[model samples]
Target: MGIQYFSQVLIFGSFIGLLGWTITNQVGRTQLQVKSREDWLLDGTGLTIQGILIPLLQATLVYWLYQYLLPIQQGYLKLPLILAFVISFVVIDYLYYWNHRLLHTKLLWKVHQVHHTVTQMDVLGTSRNTLWTSLLIVYLWIHTLFLYLLADPTGYLLGVSLTSTLDLWRHSRLIIPANTKLYQFLSPWLILPQDHAWHHCCKIHNYNYGANLKIWDKLHGTYYKSKNMPSIIGIPSSLNLFQKLFFPFS
Candidate 1:
């Protein structure tokens, strides 16, 4: 949480649409609007609390975990830049895939449900989880831990930036033609907006669990490929902010 981190967030938020994916498949995009200005405020408040504050507070615990339980001497090993970059990307993506899959399980779905409460996918939707749930996100904790121990700042930047870019793009209303060369090139390899939308789809929610790559889903037999849109968006068992924050115990 230094100036560099904020700088990257600012840059990533601005110009996320530079890739021109937001306008594809217009029919599939679901537009959501707030009924009042206060609704927007509430949304912003929730995002800040869960996405920023809680994570910042929990980082102290992560530091302690690193210092005591997971300390490794690999930082001095000085991995090659190219090797570190590729390994970090692969490692994070693989871990994220399984972790995302875990979120869909019956036991874990309650903790992860806040993210699916919104009917529409927007960039802000990325931070829709509750404070406690956000703190426990497998990728946020594990990925940072890996970079802390094994990767230099430069290698970590590439891995984090690439994933961040993919994440922001995944939440957009964009669509890539499944039959086009670009879609084929990126599909089952990179996460396409349509692929992610299916994950949010109520009926087909069990499929497309990969965060960055379709490889894991395919390997685990959860991969689904089709031009169809989901029957509906948003989980049926959605929770309000209070329930989201203190859910199951609320």
Candidate 2:
């Protein structure tokens, strides 16, 4: 199990590195500008202990509930390992689109603002978040439920883990070369740096709220395209760390 887990981690790390390298090499320089050191500390920094802990806590809690509380034994829900991976991936990403959109709503934006508050993009930026947002969000619950139902936690974890690699690439400060095969292959399906860069380009326009693919944004009218993109990204509010950390409530 350890070997398999380590191998998966290695693969994900390599993929992010490859994508990040392509991006950095192609973009000439990172378009994202750092506005303030205070801004960097407040939002730009990656997963703190709290950020990492919350996700793990939520995933584990949901998984354990399904294992012990749910009636899996009443009817066997065993899925072939391969099929489990496919089902988990499809359902999780599909649900993630809606989850991402709802997080932008008036009520939740206070919590989600901690993320968009970052003025620049980096791998760690993807991991930034509030603890309360993690357990309450539909997307995390979907992931936990899928893992518990399939009875193959390994595949479930593998599928969920793949998103981070893609996310890291999307938030990277690098740019994909216009001429690369990987660039061409990844452009249509995955949320590449350019896609997310456009998202952060505006506060209201070009939300581009898809986590994995463009299908949802295209299906809905939220998609925005343009010859110009914003040079800076962040919410309009001027909250400090303490305020942001306890936002929408505290």
The clash count of every prediction, one per candidate, is 0, 4
What range of 10 consecutive residues in model 1 has the weakest lDDT sum?
27-36
lDDT of 1 by residue, 156-215 (tens): 556666766677677655667767888767775876777788888777788888777778
Give me the candidate number with maximum lDDT: 1
User: For model 2, how does the per-residue alpha-carbon lDDT over 31-73 read when each residue is reduced to its tens digit?
Assistant: 3243355544543343553344545765577667766877654
Compute each candidate's TM-score over C-alphas.
Answer: 0.80, 0.78
Show where candidate 1 strays beyond 4 Å: 1-11, 14-46, 49-51, 54-59, 70-74
* Model 2 C-alpha lDDT versus the unseen true structure: 0.62
lDDT of each: 0.65, 0.62
Clashing pairs in 1: none
